[model samples]
Target: MVASVFSIYVRTVHRIWRQVKNSGMHVDVSHKRTGNCGRKRIQIDLTQFLEIPLRQWTTLDSLACSINMNKTTLFRRLKSGAIRRHSNAIKPILKEENKRSRFQFCISMLDESSIPQDPIFKGMYNIVHIDEKWFYMTKKI
Candidate 1:
């Protein structure tokens, strides 16, 4: 069945990832998987990318490629509010939920301390950068 194949594939990927880590091999993944498919010729603006997709594509990589801009440029536009999101880009759940919702849902985030951490780079991360002038270098190169 499909489930068994998926399980085997997941196991294979995990085993490979583990082996690569254990062997201290750093894989430099450079190329991306997808492109805008000739949309780059039209020079689609940021608004067109956001509006036509109707806010479905939330990732920065996709938005950047679709609008033919790099991630840094897209982030700069977003921070400067040059690009605006369409109205009701995210449609609400319901009118009743909007009208009569007395209390907001209380949510809790529990990160995976339970899941096994990566074995490689275990002890190397504990050392902090001990420069006093590290602040001026935060947003700069």
Candidate 2:
């Protein structure tokens, strides 16, 4: 009846029951498989991975080869969120004079109505600067 309800073969259920009886352990839970039953996951040491040169980590194949790991496994690890990718960017440094020139240019661009001129110049009052401070430009590598 238990086998019919669970849709398992009676012989299979009886075999499991006999094994449990012999082991002198009662089934406390309905789960057939024990915890940690499947194939164990590979444990990767991240410090070793981080210590690898930047040049080697640029490509998956190169990274895998450098780390002495399989390319597919490494790709899988990346896809599964086990690994992370970083993008390198460099910020352009501007001198104090350059910043002052930029500020002057920005002020000059203000609505022509404010600037007294023979020909009316259109002030770009509509333009909004997202970052008022630390205006260094960034270049992505």
Error of 1 at 72 (Å): 1.8
| Candidate 1 clashes between residue pairs 3 or more apart in a chain or in different chains | none
lDDT of 2 by residue, 1-141 (tens): 999998998997888888788777875536668765998777778888878877666567878888888888888888899997665433336779979999888667556665666535465577676864444432122
Which lDDT value does model 2 have at 41? 72
Identify the candidate with maximal TM-score: 2
lDDT per residue for candidate 1 within 1-141, as digits (tens), equals 443765755565666677678877876423344673444432336456635452334456666665566878777676767764433323434666665543332111222353366322233345475766544422311
Regions of model 2 farther than 4 Å from truth: 7-28, 32-35, 88-141
Q: What is the C-alpha lDDT of each candidate?
A: 0.51, 0.72
| Location of the lowest summed lDDT over 10 successive residues in candidate 1 | 102-111
**Which pairs of residues clash in candidate 2, taking residues 3 or more apart in a chain or in different chains?**
110-123, 111-123, 112-123
